[model samples]
Target: MLLDAKFTIGQRFKHIRIEKGVSQAQLVDGICSIAVVSQIECDRKYPSAELWGKLADKLGVPLRELIGMQEKQMEVSFQIDMVRVYIDKADHTHALELIDELEQRADLLEHQRIELLICRAECYRTARVFEKVVELLVPFLQNQQIRQNVEDVVLCDTYNKLGNAHYWLNDFEKAYFVFNSLDPDDVHFKISNCRCWNTLGNRG
Candidate 1:
């Protein structure tokens, strides 16, 4: 998840940089010191509010778009192996109970709720209730706080799942729409893109 967040922020910064068509040094001029911009893009440090505002102004984006609030919500990083063990060995009832307990005590930071939502969506997906996944995820996509917190991969996965669910219901139009919402250049888009194309072919 940390990797996903890092990549998302990096991609956003790169997108803004390209949109502005300015060199790193040029972007730093009169905005932030050159070293600071370098550090921010490299994910070594977050930019200050003043620097964030300047970047947003230069890049023609909303100031909120440049802020990453998800980092604050990550209180503890659970071991992936432990999670896998629980998923693999525990019964559904027990798993649900554990998840419910975790959710209740999560106490997530500003944007951290998105992570929780994603986790919940996955759980719903595993239960083969795709409707529940959609129910949980669609709101997050539309929410400003959650949207800002989501990484590109998470966004891709959410859209892919939504498309998949619609496809299963033979709602081809909705599936196609969801798949088209993804940016082709994003790493997570490939599988959904293929599925969309395949569905189109079948329909034709």
Candidate 2:
């Protein structure tokens, strides 16, 4: 769930730094001035991507999690986490119940929309409600704005879910088409191609 990264990044960094007993001077490490780090910690400024990555590494968390606090601008972190836990438990019914409300908040941020869609799609996948996953993902995948703007990992995840749904529905051609559209260089494409071909081979 890649997110905007500007949200709560500073606060999270500060907290993690303190928890890890890392000093302000240690965190500075020449990536930026200590004052700049202070500004970032206070949410007074946003760090450059490279600087933030260094900061997250020093703090011992993934840059993705920094924004994934984006679940972007996760005003509803706890609510979303509950939905995630339910989905992971394969309780789609319960997850969907919570998801309906989450969808409304998604309208507020691009990352939220992507995150909620991912969560919904995964819940459907885990529940074997493949149709719902397809239904939930297709428009987002096709929306030029959404498609172009979505994070690389999020786009990959969207296509992965859609491809899996189509495969399960025995729509192998659609599955292949979707998976084939992934970048040849992407590792996921190779993995899915194997599964896609196996599915077709078994049918043949």
Candidate 3:
């Protein structure tokens, strides 16, 4: 399973427990300590098979049901991995095709959706389809929940790509604004900034 899939499972597990009115102490009373339960629910640790079975019983669900979630996530992860490979090879046509399929899947967790959008925007940017890149990523970057939930690296990459799209379109004002919004301490941001400067100098 993808690392983000583990995160999704943890978040979904917590949501289910809350909806069922099962307290942390109540859920893990016999199977494990509340600390262990907390760790699992927070994505800090994975549960053992024995623990998974006990938790499933407590929640009145089948173990296979829980396992099924992981399987679906793994399947999605494989497709996303293929998208990355296609992007790396400059195969934007194929990358966009896979991204289109990913966008239609309702089972994708929030982080997965964010990743798909980023990948699609990148394909557009690489193909010199700057208008499409901006159209695709602008709303995603505007969502506060998405910005807060995604990893720093993912966020950085999104900004970098958006900034580059603006730069290519000769929208330097927006490009600078986007680039300046990133953290100065991030190595990715610094590299992106340098690229922007180089592009500007070349034009000058």
Q: Best by TM-score, which number?
A: 3
Q: List the residue pairs that clash in candidate 2.
A: 67-70
Q: Model 3 over residues 52-86: C-alpha lDDT tens digits?
A: 65786798754444433452344787667656656
| Model 3 segments more than 4 A misplaced | 1-74, 145-147, 198-204
TM-score to true structure, per model: 0.52, 0.57, 0.57
Writing each residue's lDDT as its tens digit, candidate 2 over 1-204 gives: 333455476766676678779889998886668899888778787655456556766777655454343333444555566567656545577568767877776344766666777888898899898998898788878894444977677678778889889998988888877877888796544446677686667557
Cα lDDT of all candidates, in order? 0.61, 0.71, 0.73
For residues 22-116, what per-residue lDDT tens digits would candidate 1 score against the true structure? 78888877877878777777778765434555676777665434444342233333311222323443223434444554556645454444555
By lDDT, the better pick of 2 and 3 is 3
Provide backbone clash counts, one per model.
0, 1, 0
Q: lDDT rank, highest first?
A: 3, 2, 1
lDDT of 3 at 63: 46
Quote the lDDT for 171 in model 3: 83
